[model samples]
Target: MSYLVLARKYRPRRFEDMVGQEVVTGVLRGAIEDDRVGHAYLFAGPRGTGKTTTARILAKALNCVKGPTPDPCGECERCLASDEGAEFDVIEIDAASNTSVNDVRELRESVGYAPVDSRYKVYIVDEVHMLSRAAFNALLKTLEEPPSHVKFLFATTELHKVPDTILSRCQVMRLSPIREEQIAGRLATVFDAEGVTAADGVAAELARRARGGMRDALSLADQLLALAGNSPQLADLARLSGGAGLQELLGLVDALGAGDRAAALDAVAAWAGREGELAGALLDVVRSIVVAGVCGAGSPHLEGGPAAGEALLARAKALGRGRLELMLADLIRARERMRHLAGSERVVLESALLELCTLEATMSLAELEARLASLEARLGGASVAGHTAGPASGGQLPVSIQPTPPPVGASATRSVQQPTGPATGPATAPGAAPRSPDTPQPAPGPAAAPALEPWKALVGALDARHRTLADLLRRSGKLQGSGSMARILVSKASADEQALLADKRSRRACERALSGAMGREITVEFVVGDAATPPPPKVEQDPFTRQVADLFDGHIEEP
Candidate 1:
């Protein structure tokens, strides 16, 4: 086996050869030049961010026969051996394989020896986090105060696992994840060196797939080279990665935006066995959509090609910020749930996507508030759809969902009562509509003409927004009330409609709709009864009552 993989072949030999680690490499170079080098250094960061490589480079620099210069003469026998991690004096210890007290004792015993031939005996410990507690305790004395001739260099992906005493002895240098641009640039250089032709975007795509690890990027590139031979493309990268393609994810987003659940599910079926990947990729697309909604395309920066980013922006604008955020949250939650939930990951992911696609046109919180304000203003002068709700005196139905005091003589249902207060609310003009129930007001005077059909107006208003809910409510109950309170008398038989409104999210949407129709803040209480409002049965609750109780976190009681 004469072939060397690109990761080993291109390992950085000198500090300058490292990529995306200038802060760390710069500090080490400065330390070497100023001779302020510490006895022990702990390199901490994610794997493949050059922890071991940087430590090795530091060893080579210190042991170089060129008078301890930062730039080692690669031609020197010691420097060459250090580069290959074969230098007898510069020992490389993999703590993972030697995580025992005996191993540390052996290391401690050897630390007293003088450098075989190099200027200093460098002990490079990789994955030092894997050392057992006993091993760590045994090595503490040596790590704290090694001989003046010895240098200790440690590297770990999990810095927290290293004990504090051990940490205090070492000058810990935190290495950050490599940036995508730097990784891509490194990949391009490697490809150029290997005489391989690749698509313009192939390097960048591979870099992104690395997720901030130079070694990972190179490893992915090696796979790409093996599959495509000498001329790799983005398609090869996508297939080899086992992740959902951008276009497929985009199609899923498009279907979600269009409220096409089947289409969205169909679009994601290609990655059924790879639900984690599909969900993760969809999360990225939704995040981009959210970013595009907040800012323009490539506002902060761009990751993919221009066309893809612009398309994301267009889809974001079409989907609107509210829906994009909801979808983003859903995707994130689904991805997290996939980690713990049993059965097929596809089931968890697809259910979430389906739920998102079912979302009706939603407005941002700001927009919802603004629309409510505008509706109140409109109520001051005109009836909604030319109709106003009659006082509770009329034979109309009762409809209430807001959290207000229980109706007079009503004790079966639990309600969060507003503390009683004076009529601080401004007096309603001879014929003005109320603005809010924040302050309870006197019931409106009896209508001169038969109370105009306000329920009609309410249904009509909601029809434009939540057609399904509004239609169900129209058949299941009727809105009736005035001043500070409104009630919907729901027929006990309309269980389907009752269940729909009982949903936590659906209830909120319905409330928003009702608020607009009423022109003021509405305290809606749904009375699940007809003419003879009987007391609730407390002994044996029905499924509908149980569900409502669960949704509201309340219980039923007899009057």
Candidate 2:
């Protein structure tokens, strides 16, 4: 075939030509320029991050006829052959297929030979980690110290698989994943070179789809060119890439933000059916929302177009920070689970979306805490404006604050103060008024009244917040005692409610509600019967008495 793919046609011919790998190329260039090139070199990173390509470029630089220069003259006979991958001196081997001790022995024997034409005999091994232990051991000595005319270039995606012994013998270079901007800039250059007309955003979209791999971006660009011919638009790129369109992704987010479970599920189902990586696309949108929430505005920092980003930002704000975080976490988990799940990706993805849509139903602790904070703020605002008084009125103080009573059974008695100003609490209800300080004090006899007051206030507070839970507590029992020791008499209707409240989370929530209402920490216990009254004891009867009872069909009664 006469046609060359973009990946090969645009392959970096010189160290300076490599993209998004300045460090690796700079080091190699300096090594060649200073004539300090090592006998063995290892390049490692993710796939399509220029490991093998850099190795090839390094090989060419060393073998060029114009001495060991970083810049190889493309017109030179040796450089031309090396670029063509046909040079007799620069041999490229796929270690994946040639992973044997015998192969290493053959390679070792060839390393000692002088170059047929080039200055240096370069051996490039791709996927070097695939070689077996025996193969590695066989080549260790040769790699550690090779002939003056010979050079070894090794490339691997998994650096950890390379033995430390092998690693110690070579100059290792770590390459990082290419950034999106770098990939997009490279794509734009390719587009211009090919005489293809594309929007600026088109290249960026393709770059994002590449997921930090330059080769992937170029390959995708090639596909887009073929599909759209000479003039490719952003829509064409999205269609060819099998990615969820901006509108579709935005619709999904809107559905979730609106709590429309069915719509969200439908969106997932459609996206899953059409796109290869539905969950990943959804995760991207969700992650963008989380970022936008943090930024507190709709910034066009995400992969999509401006309008889509704005819409997403608006939805993110409407959904609030807590819901966005939960949604983000759910999407991430679903994507991970999809990897291990077979033939059920759509089901899992839809289920995850639906779950996120109904996040309000399953309130997380973080959400509850945020709600409580808002409630506290409102209450605090109300408390500050509760009372005001003038000094001219009989020299009475304007502000009166009520101090909570001390624990029951304490020797000291604390009096409740009446504010001369308006009251703000529930105690200031229509008929209820604060007692005057001069009024005769009521004697405290039973501890039940004080103990029950807090519990009643707690029930009312719970009712205002969570009605169902408050109802459950109302049926649970009546308060029986005071102070550090108080009890609730459990009835038959509250058995199930009590069991449910026994959960650690539920119990803690109840305790928090009680503490907030009472303004102090108090211990509560559940009792089955009356705490003050004792049950009757049973007496055993003699055998004759039992026989007499049996004859009359009567049972003995306990006293």
Candidate 3:
């Protein structure tokens, strides 16, 4: 007898045998038990996900010889015949091949008749979405209102292609892809039943490669078994799939995470030189890193040895979740581009590996913002100390000069008395002097100019420190007064300059400089005023004028 492939041998024989589709199974079971099964049912999902198989089981459950039982007894002739694909009452058609109006018309006509031997006539159309538009129109009425004795099961991977009109008439059951872990467990059972000795990691690897498809998993296992005689080792399975050993792949990831470009490039080059599957190797590495990140260290999901798994976990931690997600995206894009590139697989794989290795792990936006704040704080502090000093000449002061008391017994004391003559004002009390008519009395010696304040000192310091700023201050007539309360008359140009210096750091620096220059602390205050213009230039004699005078017979005197 020819050897039966794993896929066919492990096909679900009953509802209990179905995996990863408990919802659909339960609904169908309840329908069967309640005898409320719809006339037309549509099963839609991906390939190898048991759409066609479930259709067959449903047909058998309805057409069994005993009755329309929820659980068909396989011992009965009708059930046995249906399972073997030889039942006369159960008609299975490949819609992909028989998609014509004529075919649908014939099916419609046949549905009118009752079952010859079974309880109900069942028609299972696989890939029903492949049917032509005319075919769908021909069968629409029959599907919507089929005879009591006729049952229809339609399976399609592309449900969108099936018109909404047809979908509305049928009870649609959406089947999901089996989970990876469930697929692995099912494959392990198959391996045990087949007496195939698979290594520790082989079953899980095959299941992952299957991508939630049981048929594909079994097919992969069959090929491995064929290649390795009977007892397939993990290495053999990996070799057949063109995947690298988990340890090697993890090592590559570790190098990348550590930012060791050389090591990463070397590993990739070595893998590329080998005549194995570069794409598979790349995917395997990405998958292992992702799994490690999700599952944490010592996860059983990793196919490699414990050390390799631990390494991958470490790399995942170092690279972080954000980096790992970006790497996955880049790998997927590279894989797609590789198909179109006309170069050696090694070159393509190396390019992708190098890119991954050089990937700079990015911080979260929050973290970046925190860092920026820290930098700004440090800069502010430094600017306060280094950039905020008063001018070399010290800051301006508000002059309010008080006359020094006259030396004991001198006539200068009489000068403090008010003038009595017409040329001067009436005599005032001692220490109170009246203004002289001709001299205006100098306003009590300029009110003894006020002491210089800290802010003025700081501005002075800034002017001394920055030449450009000093030039700007001089040009704008910002320099004013001679004491603490001295105001820097700010013209429009100086106001614009002040606006430029309005940043928090710059303002703080100026404050610090002012504080240092003045004995007391001070703050900045702006006042607007028109700037004083410079007088017209006057012509002056040069050194050449004296030299010409010495050369001539006459002296060069001022005109």
Candidate 4:
């Protein structure tokens, strides 16, 4: 006795027996019952998606002894013969081999003859697009106007290759790939019929591996039952699919979420040879994490089922949504990179996994903003304090702001609420609080104005003018006073910057910017700050500067 594969043994016997193609089957059933059946019908879809099976069902329905009923009597001699492809009138041709004009000419010649013992002389041609142009042309007339007792059925995986002339005469039915849920549902029924005891998620995983093909799903199920002897588990299915088991994959994701780089690298090393499959498995889990985050833990879309979703929810919360999204994007790009590579697939996959592992230490955008604000507050208060502590001996205090460029066209306004006013006022005698508003007010003393917040905005505003005089002033000098601003170009210049700033044109340029902002005729003065004052603290905190300095084995030559 020959062993029958599940794909053949469970082939759809009728229109209603098919899976995941309700729309097409419903139309076909209605057409048959309403006596609106077309002379030539074309079925198009992916391989193993019930294209030929549909054609045979329709043929059996038309040629049955019951005379063109949608529900054919399978026991009839004509129906049985048609099922076996041995009927005298129901002809089945494989266009892949018989694609010549002579074949079509023979078919055309035979169309004039009557059926042996059926309602219509049926012709089912599989992969009809493989026919030569000449063969299609030879059959065009016969196909368009076949005899009343003749009918034609054509099936093709590539509908685009079928010429429009042949297509215009035939009715087209497009079959869609079955969904994983639908495939798994069908597999459950098959498992019961076969008396197989498969674990939960095993059939679901097999259906997923089928990539939307029911026949492929059935074939994989048969192979799995044969290999594992009817008691297959998720691990067995994972091994068959050339990827890690769900638990192993979950562990890798956990390592990544916890920022355990070595653990993640070790896992990557363990799956070195199957990097592509490992990448796919990792992507699946990451996708589940995203789905769990957005669609909730109990959503049915989770690929690993509820157990995997529960496990993934913990990691999803640990890594947060943004980092998980970035990690998912990285995995997608890594898979694309390894698509055509002949070797070195492990490097790309490992790098992506390591990056995801490091995602735990990375700060979210909101967190980074909070840290920057805190630092800005501390640094701003410190700088304002240092400036307020003036020399008081006819000498001025230096207020240096940290140089950070506001991106182009951005608002550089920063409202620093602090009394950075000049310390030139005589200290009011201690405990002297009796001066009421009604009392005669003491005349204000004369002193230089303090560097205001708008000055920093002016400097930061010139980010578009990088590596120029504007950049030099932002990096070194400080703008003080209001309308008659003092443009103190410091001694930190590299000789060329000094020449550029000391130039009259540069002074006028600064005065114009300051004047327009201050709404008055601004006079600029260039002077280096006295050595008694110090530069702003933490001004050299830009890591890029430090990296470039290290790379060049040099320091920022500030005087």
Question: TM-score for each prediction?
Answer: 0.66, 0.60, 0.55, 0.55
Cα RMSD to native, each candidate? 9.7, 17.0, 24.8, 16.8
User: Residue-wise lDDT of candidate 1 within 207-284, one digit each (tens)?
Assistant: 766767899888888888888889987777766754455676777887776546457667556665677867766787
Q: How are the candidates ranked when ordered by TM-score, highest leading?
A: 1, 2, 3, 4
* Residue-by-residue lDDT tens digits, candidate 3, 1-559: 9988988888897888999999999999999999899998999988889998998899998888765777889999988898788889989999999999999999998998889888889999999999999999999989777888888999999999999999999999999988877888898898788787777877877776666678888888888888997688877865664345556666677666554545755665555445235555656677777898899767877754576677777777767787788778877766766667645444455545545644544555464445444434533443222223333344322222233222222222121111121222123222222112223222221112322233233334444223333344444423222222222333433222332232223233343444344433333322233223221122211212222222232211221
Q: What's the best-to-worst order under lDDT?
A: 1, 4, 2, 3
Residue 201's lDDT within candidate 3 is 74
Q: Over the stretch 1-559, how does candidate 4's per-residue lDDT look in tens digits?
A: 8988999888987888999999989999999999999999999998878998998899899888885888988899988987776888888999999999999999999999998788888898999999999999998979867899988999999999999999889899999988878889999999999889899888888776666689988988887888887878876775564445667777888777654655766876777677887888788778878888888878887665777678778777766777788788878987997886647576656556645543323344465445444434533653444445432222343444332122121121111111222333245321121112232222222213334443543443332222265556755665434223333434355423433443444455455445444545555645433233233225322322222323233222221
**Top lDDT hit:** 1
Who wins the TM-score comparison?
Answer: 1
lDDT of 3 at 536: 14
**Which portions of model 2 miss their true places by more than 4 Å?**
242-288, 295-312, 315-559
Q: Candidate 3: where are CA atoms >4 Å away?
A: 242-288, 298-311, 330-360, 364-559
The clash count of every prediction, one per candidate, is 13, 0, 27, 0
**Candidate 2 lDDT tens digits, 1-559:** 7879999999999988899999999998998889899989999998889998998888888888785789988879888998898999888989999999999999999998898898889899999999999999999979777899998899999999999999999999999988877888898888899898897588888877776778888888888888998888877865785566656677887776655655765665456454237777777777777776666444546654566567767877677776677677878887777777776566566556645644533345565456556555544443333234222212222221222232232222111111122232222221111122233222222334444344544455454434444565565444433333333333322222322333223334445555554555534443333222222212212222222223233211221
What overall lDDT goes with each candidate model?
0.68, 0.64, 0.62, 0.66
